[model samples]
Target: MANILLVDPDDNAFLALKGFLACGGHRSTSVSNARDAMVFLRENILVDLIFIELKLPDSTGLDFLRTLREDYFFQHVPVVFYASKTTHAEIHEAYGLGVQSFHRKPYLQESIEDEVAKLEGKAWYWSFFEPDDAFCRRTGRSLDERGAALDELEPVIQSAAQAYKNVNIELAEAEKEKILSEISGFRRKVREVAVPGLEEYLSYLASFAKESDWNEFKEFAALMGYYAFLCSYRADIYKLERKAKQASAVLDRLAQNALLRSLPPHEVHALIPHLRDYEIDEGATLFKQGDVGDAMYLIDEGRLGIYVAMEDDSEPKKIGEIGDGDIVGEMALIKNAPRSATIIALKDTRMMRMEKDAFTRATIQSPQMKLAVQALAAQRSMDSIKKRAGEIDISAWSKTASEGVRKMGERIPNGFLRKDEKESEDIKREAESMDHWNKMIDSQTFPVVSDAKLKRDIAALKGCPVVGSAVAAFTLATEGMVTSLHPLMDLAEHDPGLAFQMLQNANALRQAKTKDLESFIDDARLCVNFLGEKRLSVVTKGFPRCCESFMYLNEGANWASHIKFLLATANIARFTCAEMELLNIERAAFLGALLHDIGKLLFLRVQPAGCIPVYLHAQEHNISIRESEILHMGISSRQMAIQFVENKSIPTSCKNVIRWVEEPEKATEDFDLVSVVAIARYMCRLCKVGFSGETTQQDLLPLEHSQLWNSIKDRVLQRFNVGNFEILVRRRLRKF
Candidate 1:
């Protein structure tokens, strides 16, 4: 039976898992938290597996796992995380900490059993965790003794190391041949010299060479061969271990460098494994002018000179020098061109090489890195252009220009190109505003519903066969009423839910646009016609399915009331857009109005009883529905609606209007469209056209109070009469 440690604070969860594991023929040890688990582990009890609840009294499951992994004994032990509520980010962190498995607590018992069964057949080995220390440790002989005995091999080892380093650096034909010869001589010397720790064995073989005792000599020869093999193997292992440690040190330095400081830790971690270290001799040419570039190098030690060839076959001139922590050869790699200038080491140097493919992969995962690279490349290109411009014969070019042109140039003031204080202040203000908005977006956190749950709700709604027929009948009746081509029939035969939504949207538009409330007709054809064929098709295809889902999930009375509010808002938006004429997006405005509260529909579907508490909370607090929803769900209804519509094939304009309707000031591009929809929604809420699940009235801000509204008010007021529009809306609200 395998020994398992279970860490959980909840007594019920602990007992349930303990009992289940016992039934499965496993021995189990239980603890209430990470602290107790640590104490239990220190008792030297063997554990084959660990089951940890993400939440504990003392420390988090991830923290416990991280600390456990640091202990050599538990590094190979399998860890399974169990939690009732776990986010994707948390799950990612658990895996990053080397967790073997993750499962939701108190569920998926069978899957957990399967995972355990598979582990039983697997062989556990300590060698898999780390390399054998004996293979890397030196022989028992004193360092001085070994050094004297291997005096002939010391030069060979240094030459071999130098050859390996040169494999990464660019070299001339003569230098390449010299390094290759050194490597060949080193290999030959290693085979000829006596191996360390095998000197006595070799001496015994030499003495027995002339002896008549064949059996004794054979034994001596075998011992000599075995010791030689061990000495060679240990030497290779030690070299590899040293190299790995060096690379790791280089990675640590790179991670903290200014160029990579802005990258996320995970992205920087991904880049560490791909970096390779190289040591260059003093005055070595790293690369030459016009040579094809395949990798970029980071200077770890010493300095390098950048040189450019002069015109007419003159000698290459040193333009600049880069010291430690600077990167070079990146421009050629990024541009996919030959080296712009030759690079040569000024002193004995250590560098890290990152290949083109690895650099491309890294930048793809880190957009900030890509931007920084581009900005640097642009600055270098501009510097090169400026240097070339300075060399040009300006007097020759000026002689070709007209006298009047030269006179005009001479008359211009030197300080005329400088920016005025007002212009400079405007630029600074714009920059500050963008920076503030970026921080605001980054800091805001929204509650994310899983895709599986949302899909399941949609599927359940679609499976209700009655919704489709009801929607089709309502569509035909509404069309007939708007066209005046058929008699008005009783609404009982058709789907009341569909008919109610249609009537509300129609009347809402009429009240917002017309001077009289009586002029409003309860019809769907008008909305469809106003949307035009393309937009109408998009709305008709998706909106009906959504409405059916809402009807299937919610009570009829509540669904009807919610749809009425949306319809009234849509109608008001259409009227405002038509009257203002500033934005020619009447169809988009109407569509935005209808879908503004779509997020509420999703909330209702996910939790049918969730709205009751939200409304009650808003009523008690005397707040708006948006504010109440944010308090209850960690996001406003507008954010939820934006997430839902992102997956649909709707027009971007319509989506933007819906997204920014609640906060018109945030609409950077479609300000007019967003403002019109916002005004209409606010007016409808003020009029209380239908129940919006908000029991108490919310305070309304005047149009003049908003910066966005004030900016466009003069233009709108010049053509439209706001006083007359309010009178018309008040009269229309009396009927509702």
Candidate 2:
């Protein structure tokens, strides 16, 4: 109903107004003169509508409307003129002053009712308030021609839901990539068609309120909210996929840790997201003995000392220390018991902690992690059982050694690997490893080692611990009629246990091996020189390294591949060494080149179908493999190699090369060696001699002309300019 102010003084006019007002429930306030009407209009300037008679006793319609338009709310009010015997000029002037319409004297009540009903909704006032008439016409035209906006958005929204499903399924790598393309198409469709089409419709509907059909607009907008929800759904799907991929990468990295290796790959997959980051300052007790254990922690960095209670509680005797890659408190978490021992951070330690509840929930479905903990706890009972050489026969010790190791299940996060994927080691000899530390923690009698025990422990060890494929290395070793033992020896450098076995088999050591053995296998090449021909032959005859993928080169025929690419990298490294004229690093550089990509092999195993999330991210963003691995996994192949070999007996210079081969400036110890391997690999990648998962084609950074050239360029000889080096590399590549 309309709010009208009538200015006619005539009583007959009041009865005539009933034709529209009485039937339609329209409200009106009438005045006998312009004086009263003007007073009412001034007080209620924001009135919805106004009606006036030109034959009013005090004033004309023109004078009233002129004042309303000039001094009042300025043309914002709709006005109608109703008068008897009004002149044409007076009507023309009122119409020119923006009166909505003119009603003739004694007009039919029904005819007036039809005109008033036209103003039943705010569409009458909308014309005065919302002046975008052209846009309103356009919005209405689009609605009639294109049908509803939902017709366009509905199909796209449904396709987005389907695309999200395709994203989560375990598809082939190529198929997964195809899903990504479809997702990209969905996003483009929304941006280009769906969103643009809905823009005018939504905005056109938004400007309306108090209209009779307002409920219809509100309902339509509510339906369009699904399109809005589709927008959020698409966005959240991207975030979840990214997070899952990141968790998958974390799964792969966590699988490589030493303590968690007891858990199967699938269990680690389920557990990665639940792991909590925790830090303890140096000397702080991680957890006190007898405290209620709610969590277990895996050390990512630094060390912790195990303090067990003794008779009479003698200051919590410190028995042993565990460092990075080791886990603590599994026994407490598993048994649901109080912590048996106190753990204090020996240094500022960073660990991944998992609450019991979170652990249970994360691993409830994938129970391999739980089973590993149980198996180790059950097996740990054996740790307390002391079997001295004086107490047991030689054959018994051999048998115990054979029982501990799970040969084929070494590297982390290969959930797809089956139970039978392990080595063909004699079932009798390839048993579990008898950890001396576990026994020390159990029996508290730290004894000297035995030869049989040593062979047992080394036999249980993986070929390459952090990132090698002993299987691939073994494949390399037995590729031909001649049993090439080079991989085993090279593998021994990364794996000191492997080196110890090779050396032990040679029987050339001066002293008997001890249980407290620290690795000094810094140099891999020295293994052959140190062992004479007969001893070397003995080591060669026995190559039982079924662990990491040591990238050893035959250097004869296949040498062009396994080490040949590195030979090119080495030539560049040697040139860098000669430029500095520091000849010592040439050896380290050469060795580093051969060993640099063990991280790539490790990554390849982690996701044989390509870490699809990592792959798509790299493919889309144009990031290097190491960078992508670091983005999602928090570690790179370069860092993995560093972690694998940091404690090896290798020279510090070689470790430096490995540490900064891709990132030379980050090196703290030996910048020259870093630069050598850095520029060497950069040049080698440019040569395209072979494929390196670590270095992509996009990785041809600006290093050729970068300041790194100063480290390797010969200032005196002028032998290593970028232009000349390019020509040299291309020539070598062409000839080879």
Q: Count the backbone clashes (under 3 Å) in each candidate.
A: 2, 24
TM-scores, each model vs. reference: 0.29, 0.30
The digit string of per-residue lDDT tens for model 1 on 1-736 reads: 4666778865445444543453354556578888888777655234557789998888899889988887543455678897767899999999998887888644333655776786764423222212233322434444333334345455445444333433333332334445445434544444333332333333443344334343454444433332333334334434444444544454555633445533333345456667888778889999999999889998888889999997876689999999886788998877888999999989998988899999988776554366556656767433332232232233322221222222222211122221121223334533553454345435643322334554455445421112232333333323311433121122211222333344444444456667554443433444434433343223334432322222322221244455567667777788888778755678667766765565665564444334555555554555666777666556665666676555333346656876787677777767777888888876665554554555533222233333445555653557576657755665555544
lDDT of 2: 0.50
Per the 3 Å backbone cut-off, how many clashing residue pairs does candidate 1 have? 2
TM-score of model 1 relative to the true fold? 0.29
Ten residues in a row with the worst lDDT in model 1?
411-420
Please report, in order, the local distance difference test score of every candidate based on alpha carbons: 0.54, 0.50
Best by lDDT: 1
Q: Each candidate: RMSD to true structure?
A: 28.1, 34.7
lDDT of 2 by residue, 1-736 (tens): 4566667775435433532353344545567776776666544433456677777676777777887777412345677887646788888898888898898654444555566666765533233222224534654433222223334555665554344333322332335345345535544544433354334433443333223244443344333443444344334333444555455445444543533443323334446557878999999988899999899887778989999988787688989998876778878877878999999988999888989888667544433344445545776522212211122233322222222121112222122121222333422222322243234325634222333443343334333332222223322333333334444455444332333344343322422343333333334546544554455544444543322211221111121143345546766776656655668767666666656555544433332222334544454455565566565555654565556554444455655666676666667877766776777777666544443443233213334444555454553245445655555555555433
